[model samples]
Target: MTVTEAEGDTAAQAPMGSSSYSRFDTDWLSDATLALFATGGTSPLFATSSTVEVRYLGTQATREASLSFQGPALFDTRSGCNFATALVDEFCLIDSIGTARTLGDLATGTTLDFTLTAQPQPLGSPIDQRASAESFSSLASARWIDLGGGQYLLGFEEGNDASYNDMVFLVSGATATLPSPALPVPELPTGWLLAAGLAALAWRHHTRR
Candidate 1:
């Protein structure tokens, strides 16, 4: 069973430092949906076109601009360029050890794209170690993007594996009330039965009149 930390386990509870240097973490945010498919033994493969929006609630400390959240945990793992930052907007982080890096220099779009070959040195080191299973597996292929407006939509699925490709845009907005167990929605036809019947009744009454 792939165990997760207790509910209260977060950057808030750890003895972390200001946004100064890079800090490694075992936990990075994965789409709650992905966590389900990629359970302890089952790794969910992100398809091309699978996108999600994320929100970042700013953090402050002692009235100083202390960067919060586990930034490097996600920033270091950018296999094949897994994320992008918007133009005019840059990806910045102050690690627990006071390592600060920006993604603005890496991408050329309002939003950047992922290219395994086009990764930054500092950003690539942690990811490499993780993927090799030589370091914190958490850092392996797991870097966070600067979700614009504090949120982003990340889509990169293309029919199961990496064969049939589409741009899974990492757009932002929309939160799943419950992230686990990807929720199902009623098909349009199935859900419209009542509305369709109501419309039919009104039409019949009008004809009778």
Candidate 2:
């Protein structure tokens, strides 16, 4: 997932290392499950870093899907930045029409096509002397929760804290959509450099507490 400027601008052409976007695709492993493909990318001057992961617990079949994001970086070195990792300015979820949709049931092994996007709050001011301050979604993971009927809950990781209250999506029928809520593009100081590798593999550390 390479970082790109808002409004379909790539990071290479951006004026400064601020907001960006990326897109990824994955497949469905179950009737009610969508494997959120893992991806990681960096911005110029290493100003922003991002990683995502989603998987299923059981077996099933489906087709390829896509997800996108349009917001500031989640990991930043500017603690004093304005919109850095604020959530309110960021948003990410299954991108679809309307507010809600359905995905049938998992027990029946009914696969469906869909798309999801992850967005964070708007970009904040550049980092200041507060270099020690760091903001990040290290635990940016997601899972599916059965809500009975054709509705399902899509939960995502949030904050540095070990909590699952970050974001949720409800699928009611064959389609599922989530409202763009407040997302934060937190700024964090650089410390240990993560070993470079595949996008999905590089982000495993971010999942750890």
Candidate 3:
């Protein structure tokens, strides 16, 4: 889905570094919080430095998921930046929380592609599902959020539930350029707007029950 900017002279572009929206509650991290472009298309993350750090934030899914990267210099064995050494073949694991890994020798200003795979549990189907940043086959499986300062939040939706909170990670030294259009900022704090949206969702869910 394309996110278009507003028309007319009053439309202002979001700042380059920080997200257009406000900070989300920490509790939302444990649950399926709203993502800026949850149902829309995502852009590739570009490396800002020769080396980028990826930290496992946390996962709320029951599936055994693994995160991997694919890029021009990522798996090049000749550059000594092979998948096994330069990049962690399995950078983040479902059970390995709060762990961080560095991807070295990445070419600056280039896209760093990512793939998230969800392993089948004993009780679930035996098929392994995959989501990719460069592929549109599973567009809803992955979501990217700019957290400013060359940091981004990447989330994946492993199951059909549409909760992109299955696997969440923080990537530093990388940036993603979204195609969203400029929006008019209201007088209220951006955080309050985000909170109000969440409150509405919660209230709707509560009433349904």
Candidate 4:
């Protein structure tokens, strides 16, 4: 099926750092929603079941982002599932804001690989840009936030802005099999270390005196 705008009269607003021509209009998500899920943790996600449900949460992107999926360990065979035919091939589930769609039940043990294709601009010679969770080279393009209870919040950064709020989705029956980004270790500055060393030497000299 083709992607179409959701029903309802909605107003469009330009996302931050985007031109007027690029507008997103939807109410399913807001800044608070993004903040709530921002710290939920991120990692490469997989479908726990063949029957996965997806809901278009919202978008804050300049380009038109569409959702699709391929499955049964097609992207990463090392994920461990037996080789099976792709459950879905580039199906357009959501192409606009506030739309929700579900994929038909797939074979059990099928690991899902989600993709988001950025449609070409209406006025320019831009070509379709695609990003997938299976592509480790550009893993930053897609992020999966575990929402717990077999649900997840998937977001895509369709452009260089790195605002994953571009195309947000609420997915059910998914889990993160990979580790999330770890917090950086804290370390003292070189000046602090030098001062500590000098203080220790002074203390020793005082004791000897």
Candidate 5:
């Protein structure tokens, strides 16, 4: 479950400044095979054609992974390391909605594997917290690799749960378009407040795709 995100199979490159970054525009048809699995629930994992942007912030020396799609809510709680930018090649945010929403750094092999962990909560509880339950349950595990040249290999188990663990799904696709890194990154809208948790998308419901 090791994923490598880098430029060719060479030394890693850092974004010269805040403006330098890499943008990937997804091609749906190339990945239309996403329908071969079941996706929907509290953690709706998707390999469909969505906008994915990755960039390195020179000031922080950390990379950002952004995924924006028009669909139902997928992620809820985000847990891992806090915002200090010290750890390398480890889980940072299971889900994020801020500028540094991605997992990985300026170095190679930073974007490793992704796992889905969840625990049931007692009803009528007024609070929702991460790891509150002593026995945390593992829902699924996936392996993703960055094949360079704006291409990626994502393999995961669909409908993975206590009942299903025998199915695995894999997908690959090249970006339809890329963005010029010379331009400055856009700013988030004013007052776009995020919850206290690490930045992950706050999605609204949509019709099944």
Candidate 6:
């Protein structure tokens, strides 16, 4: 495996260097996409970073969203400098047909294709051991949930936190990008990344204690 493709530790998952979205593709929130134009995509969100999960999907009666993050760097806000290690923004294409919103939650038939670009550390060293208060640029992620038979919502959240409650998301039925994305963010994992889109259906709701 190439140096970039290798998996790193967690602590760096959350912006604050916590352990949340640090699992492999099978993990709850650790989603990796290759770069589009970069000829090669980088694992921007790889390693010790924390990720969040919703105990309830868009199908959960739209009540208080059952969301939770188990580490630092977890975010939830409109905008602000994030615990992200890089200063790059991500891109995605919605393929359904709801409100044509930029980002939000996902519904049963709702689908979106997004990409991420990991900024390589100076010496490839793990970051945020202590999760310094050094606020850099803000990072964001969007998702679409399947609320049972054809129901959907698109959700987008900025900043990093450990709360997935009542956080508004997008409605589904919006025509989004294709599952087998023609382009990736960093430009790696051509086959596997595309597989991820197809496998997104396996995610089970995460209930926080």
How many clashes in candidate 5?
A: 6
Candidate 3 residue-wise lDDT, 22-102, digit = tens:
112242242233444365237677777677776655544433445666522111101211112212432222223344567
Count of clashing residue pairs in every prediction: 41, 40, 1, 0, 6, 81
Candidate 5 vs candidate 6, lDDT winner: 5
Query: Which tens-of-lDDT digit does each residue in 23-106 have in candidate 1?
Result: 122233323423232222112222112232221122111111111122322222212112221112223331221122222221
Residue-by-residue lDDT tens digits, candidate 2, 36-98: 312211111111112122221111111111222233221211121122322333322222211
lDDT of 4 by residue, 1-209 (tens): 12223333323322322322222333445455555544445555655655666665555443343466652111111011111111122221222334445555555444556666554434322432333222221144666666689887777666565556556677777677732445799999999999999999999999999
Q: Under the 3 Å rule for N, CA and C atoms, how many clashes does model 3 have?
A: 1
Off by over 4 Å in 6: 1-140, 162-167, 174-209
TM-score-best of 3 and 6: 3
> How high is the CA lDDT of each candidate model?
0.25, 0.26, 0.49, 0.49, 0.26, 0.24
Which of the two candidates, 5 or 6, achieves a greater TM-score against the reference? 5
Deviation (Å) of 26 in candidate 6: 33
TM-score of candidate 5 versus the correct structure, residues matched by position? 0.23
Answer with 2 or 3, whichever has the higher TM-score.
3
Give the Cα-based TM-score of candidate 4 against the true structure: 0.50
Any runs in candidate 4 off by more than 4 Å, and if so which?
Answer: 1-28, 35-42, 71-96, 122-140, 178-209
lDDT of 1 at 11: 28
TM-score result, candidate 2: 0.24
